[model samples]
Target: MTHRIAAFGAALLATTALTVTSLSAETLRWARAAEALTQDPHAQNEGPTTTLNHQIYEPLILRNMAGEMEPALATSWEPSADNPNVWVFQIREGVTFHGGETFDASDVVFSLNRAMSENSNFRELLSGVTEVRATGDYVVEIETEGPNPLLPNNLTNIFMMDEGWSVENGAEEVQDYAGGEDTFSARNSNGTGPYVLTSREADVETVLTLNENYWGIGEFPLDVTEIIFTPIQNPATRLAAFLTGEVDFIQDVPVQDLAQVEAADGIGLGTGPQNRNIFFGLNVGADNLERDNVDGANPFADVRVREAMMIAINREAIQQVVMRGQSDPTGAMLPPPVNGWTEELEQYPEFDLDRARALMEEAGYGDGFSIQLDCPNDRYVNDEAICQAAVGMFAQIGITVNLSALPRAQHFPLIANGETDFYMLGWGVPTYDSEYVFNFLYHTRNDGRGSWNGTNFSNAEMDEMIVSLSSETDLEARNATIAELWEMAEAEMIYLPIHHQVLNWGVSDAWSTLVDADDQVKFKYFELN
Candidate 1:
């Protein structure tokens, strides 16, 4: 009996491996509910495309399972004793890009410089570094304008592109997600990741294969890999694909289908509370056609109007109707895990229609006003439904929100350029630090940098707090700064924190390894059981 059981277990292992290996000979077959809109990481900041880009490009540093920064292309880094602002990194030797060209300090320098150069989306994240220099063959040093300590985590998107491949392909600058002319980085990618992009069918399918010459650990146990991404606009159609086993994984699982999916056989449901906050941004700085025309100015500018809008939002209705009880009404941008930052911060004023109407009246809008609410149709979980629900809630207070739903590729640029009035956005903390929030969303503009502050929101005190928080080595002081920052944001009604989404992925039992970090899936760690 013992020998028979041993033979059976061996056969099972072989069977599982064969099941994965027989898919496409050179490509492992994987499916997701959505397709990537763009292959460029710098160009594609939306959620769906970010996942596909994960398999195609390799960031300078990748996060480990514990959410800690680990070496990828860069082996180690050190801060200068004389000045905390000066930092140096040692690049790994003998590493090569996917195109067979050797990797060096020049690639790192070029990538950083390009990301920080003129008219780039990533400028805000890389703004602290006053200078980035390639010191030696495998060495690079960074000089910050001030003591910037979030460098390690910020390097997550600092993906290294092949200088030779990019130049050879005539791809110099990254593509504009909006309606920009053309650029090389817009389409093709050259990286040191585990997979290579064989072909990308925008909004339809993207296929990748194992990079045999990858520098990191061996290709995940799966021999060849193929990522099939399809963006389904209808929720029922997407759920049907997963139900019928047409697709292995669905990208954004609908909340209403949780119970039904749990009851299904041969289908596995994985869920975790995502470290992302879905919220709304009001244009308090400028006026657009999609805004309230009555005031002829940004209504969000008045703290009273912003506070009223926040109160009018019935988060419970949003949770029950749209989320289907799969989300938590978060009080702040940074979730609870990152220490005392969110401890004392008060949640946005609860859904009080009367209070909201009263505030609106106080702001000289007794009859309320009409404004356009720009939202992404396929970006977040039930994103359109959430916006639709908001329409009803806001209407109760006599505020007519004209909803303009568009794809994220277009929606992001429209809002980024300050063209939208009121918009819905889902933000994930890139650095896993509260300080990341202060820098990207709050800090006053020193130059043309600082992302997502399209509201042109500025506070000199907040800027000083962020600078002090960045360089302060003491954990307690840094956390205090974060707490103070949240308090100020709350007092000022910076951005409305809606709810923290619960991430759900529908998969088959055949796939064993699954790591859902902040809902950003990296395929390198995925392996066949």
Candidate 2:
């Protein structure tokens, strides 16, 4: 069931092959289900996209594979003594971009400003920021609307771009990803990271070389001299590459095929719980949905209908059948590792087919309505199968769901641009805080926030509460507000929680890595055994 042929290969041919003489132990051949959406660091806030970008582009701060904060482009950050509203960052020195440009404070200020632009998907994480200025060379000051303590946490994925290279290539503005606008930055990259992008062929393969001038040369193991990344969307084909030793490290070892991977020799399977959750979003704010067969109104707009849909979905069944006991079924939007997740929020609603049917009848959807469910085939573990299971569950409540599964590239835009009535999404809290969750999922879809809020649920009162979490310095009060917000979101049933994902990576015994809770693979941290 595991070793099959990939349509694209050399390092991925059907039979056993060696890319650099036994993976070279220096060249790490890696494969995953999805590819980075674009090369523009600030374009997409997705897990796969950010994970790839982390290899080539250096962020001000970084969450290492072990989920600990480590200084990257910036060595240290602290609030300004002169003003609590202003935070000061000491940028790393003697760093050079792949294009041979020197790194400095101006790049941080420029990159931060660019990330706040309208087209930037990361703008929500930088909310409440009023100004960014270069106080001095290697020193930058960020002034917020008020005293902010979690600013450093949000900067982990906010990558720094060379100001001169960006401006010269007309990439000063973030790519309009939802608008389908392509720019030079989307295809090319110049970063101050450990690896340099040598070549790229989207969805096919990409090559990166070791950066001899990397600032962390001596600080890290730096044993991996080169990287070969390929996007093998087909799980069987991907596993085949790994089983045959064509690929050394595969991040997603399919749940159904985990046993087979363990049975193989010279390969190790690493496992852990990831800080992410899968959920379904509904277009509740729209008066009418284009994809649903409902007259003059949105069936999902009714809270009873949402509740009916929620209770009808059996998380236990999904966890056992679809995920193969590789998931933690959840009721809350935020994962357990997050700051605000509680036992009360973790309890999912009881599954009752009769009650679900009654609620549907009470909500005037007794006859039910047909709607298309948008899902990505390659994004999560058995993402399409999970939707398929839900189809049968929804059918029990008199709802007809037509599933449309597409590749991640085409699927994510549908949700971002408000083009889907119902869709599947997975969220990972890099900051491990509820503010990061609410800012993108609960806030109104405007003012550079809620880019991921495909639900169309808008409330001024809720938006104010979401924004307050950014600048509220009091930890006790901020957490209380987060709890209240979670209560409100859960009550509204804006999203149907599925389960938290588990991490399963298969690697060659020549190298080893810690299982990152975020499921991010930083090859720079790899240790040669």
Candidate 3:
């Protein structure tokens, strides 16, 4: 098992690693398992989407590959001396968007408000903010509902866009990604980051060239002048691209090909435990599932069925065979890097066929039932395989699973639209906090939170507990609340956690970089030999 506890812990209470890149390569071709959902920065809060955005967009603050807090568009930020609720950020001077628009505090104000809008996927992260205003030419003030100590942490991936450019292009509104609305911003972008978008073909290829006028010209290596990114969903095809030098770097090297990649000359395999976990979401709150054949009653609504399903599939076996020993089997959603993770919380119950069948019988499901398990074939490592394995395991408990695997682009919508009874999802914590997980995954679907909560689980009291995390200033007390919330989420068994994902990046010897714990690659930090 990938060292289940090898992450940075509170040290990540914590962010990125910066290594010097020499001037050598002018172009770098990158390949990953999936592509960004959209070019609109706030459209999708998915990991691949954010990672690609980091190359073109600039956030007020960002986590480097090492996972450390670093300055980006904002030079410095601190809570106002007169008001604990207000956070003041000093915008970077002389910085301009790709379209040459000057960056200022007004742009910051506009971008934040846009991110907090109804269609934005990032609204949950900024739900505590009550107001955002330009206090000066280069000073922006953000007032939260209360003292939000971890405000900066949430800003790590909240990228900023040019206010003037966005309005002119009729992209003032965020993309309604889950609703399948595609606007101008979803195909084009203008950011103040190290690179500028040359062309984007969505799932086909995206070309980016370095911004010669970027503010960080002297501060960063700026060696890689151009970037050619391709998303090859097939594992074998992606690996072959890397081996043939058709691609310079591969973000996800399949576990089955690790030995081949390691043995290949001029290739280096970078590995680390990512701050993400893979889980199966069950629609337990629904009175009757939309795809199950259990009459008017939902089998998942019963706790015994949920628990039985949870303990039936052997995680250790999946870790060894499905993942090929590149995963850490776990029961908790929060990875080791997050603020609320504890060893005790990761203790998953052992798989027992007899117990699972008995529980199924107790839940009046001993005769078994059929359910459709929606899964993504290109999203995570061995994602479809894991679902396929579960299908067999479920059969032992008299539950028949009908597997429906699709590309990430098609599979995610089913969850968002509440069209699937069961699904597979992976979450990465950019904030390195538990509040982010609870707000999006545990809270009841409402104004800003629970946008991804497809399970239909809702609890007013638990929702209150989840909401209290942003304003609770006392660290010890806030963590206590997190523990309580975790207990509640676990007791409900809304999701069955499989494991924390392990990151594997294959790099050419010509360039060097670390396996970013967040799985985000910043080309500016790539070191050339």
TM-score against truth, every candidate: 0.89, 0.95, 0.96
User: What's the candidate order when arranged by decreasing TM-score?
Assistant: 3, 2, 1
RMSD of each: 6.6, 6.0, 2.3
Worst 10 residues of 3 by lDDT: 14-23
Q: Write the per-residue lDDT of candidate 1 for residues 88-120, one digit (tens) a residue.
A: 889989887777899899988887877775545
lDDT of 3 by residue, 461-486 (tens): 99999889998999999999999888
On TM-score, the candidate that comes out on top is 3
Q: In candidate 3, which residue pairs clash?
A: 15-67, 15-68, 16-64, 16-66, 16-67, 16-68, 17-65, 17-66, 21-527
Which TM-score value belongs to model 1? 0.89
Worst 10 residues of 1 by lDDT: 1-10
Model 1: lDDT to the true structure: 0.69
lDDT of 2 by residue, 1-529 (tens): 1222211111101121111123686898989998999999999999999999999998898988767898999999999999999999999999999989999999999999999999999999888899999978999999999999999999999999999999999999999988999999999999999999999999899999999999999999978898999999899999999999999888899999999987888787776677788999999999999998887999999999999999999999998888888888888797777888888998899999999999999998889999999999989989999999999999999999999999889999999989999999999998989999899988899977999999999988889998999899999999999899998888899899998887777888788667677887788988787
What do the candidate models score in CA lDDT, each in turn?
0.69, 0.88, 0.88
* True-vs-predicted CA distance for residue 151, candidate 2, Å: 0.2
**Which is better, 1 or 3, measured by TM-score?**
3
What's model 3's overall lDDT? 0.88
